[model samples]
Target: MAQLAVFDLDGTLVDTPRAIIETFSAAFGSLGVEVPDAPEIRATIGLPLQRAFGDLLGVAPDDELATRGVRQYQIHYKELILPRAQELLFPGVAEGLAGLQDRGVTLAVATSKFHASADALLSAAGLRDRFALVVGADQVTHPKPHPESGQLVLDTLGIPAEHAVMVGDTTHDLKMANAAGLRSIAVTYGIHSAAELATAEPTWTVDTFDEVVARLDKALTTQDQGSAV
Candidate 1:
């Protein structure tokens, strides 16, 4: 059986606070509202735009203001993110992904970003071809912390939960992995701190892109040896 590694985008493979934070602030500013603090905005990184916007606006996700905020955010994101997509990738990410793919791990993306937006960014980053599958929040009934996106990715790719691991940088990602029955690896070099990630009880916590590769490599070796036995 093949091993699968599911990843999140913004705070995981991509160190993307600039586009995200600025777009969020732009959204609030356009609506004549005070923007949330950067840290508060950062805390919502892994959630769907509606949820994040809702929280920041102090309204329900479907409320008119939140909807407007999301629309405004989308506009800002395209302007801020698309032109410099590759530059947003975290250090060692390209190499780490190359190494993982070479080792025969099936890769996929499960992110809160909408499908069209996610694909556009990854393609612009020259990374769209790396994954066999990419499941965005727009493709699922619920986003991270709900397991819908992760389960959709796993089911679509015919990879069982046990044969896959979810790698991300937020509590939402780890909690989603837990719900989906996939072991979780929380990368601390992104949005959340190590201590914050611990609250989600990830199977393992790593601090760098290199550590993620090492852990997956070790997991595959263990799985291989167990099969041999």
Candidate 2:
């Protein structure tokens, strides 16, 4: 049985919705572009900044405006929002991670955020020690939905894709897991709806982190049984 768990950071284990919306609002405002509404910004949470800006403002990733937008967003997020914002973790996140760690399930984080930011957030939340590895979008040639990021995490962990499951809150995570030939599980209480997540056709869907533990237990059991057979 596989003993590895790969998780997405934002929208999966943590809720940064308000910070994200405000950051984008500030970024676009700085560039004199129309600020996208909360829902519009929310829809692009898991994507890279360049891509998100491209999708929302039609700014090419390499364009100077896009570069400025990303810089502005980061400035706002890091300086204004991050320090004062009360970090919000989804229910069961700490418990779920602890349970998995107790069971000897090696854990890692794969996020679209930069490595530094991901590290700071996890450390701030006291979850930095729980993961064996943390891979960010900047570390990979391609980001989520591209499979490279997830595969990089697997490679670093020395785990076979077949022996791992990816847990996240967006289609990007599911698509990346599927493309990497790994099982995927989606949680509905994050950025995307169950209906939106269903389009990615994850192996399982759950409403809570407690359900995540249960599902992993079932999968581990099934994997063990199959091995015995």
Worst 10 residues of 2 by lDDT: 220-229
The deviation in Å at residue 24 for candidate 1 is 0.8
TM-score each candidate.
0.94, 0.91
lDDT per model vs. reference: 0.87, 0.84
Query: In candidate 1, which residue pairs get closer than 3 Å at backbone N, Cα or C atoms, i.e. clash?
Result: none
Mind giving the per-residue lDDT tens digits that candidate 1 earns over 156-185?
A: 999899889889999999999999998888
**After superposition on all CA atoms, how large is the RMSD of candidate 1?**
2.9
Residue 202 local lDDT, model 1:
90
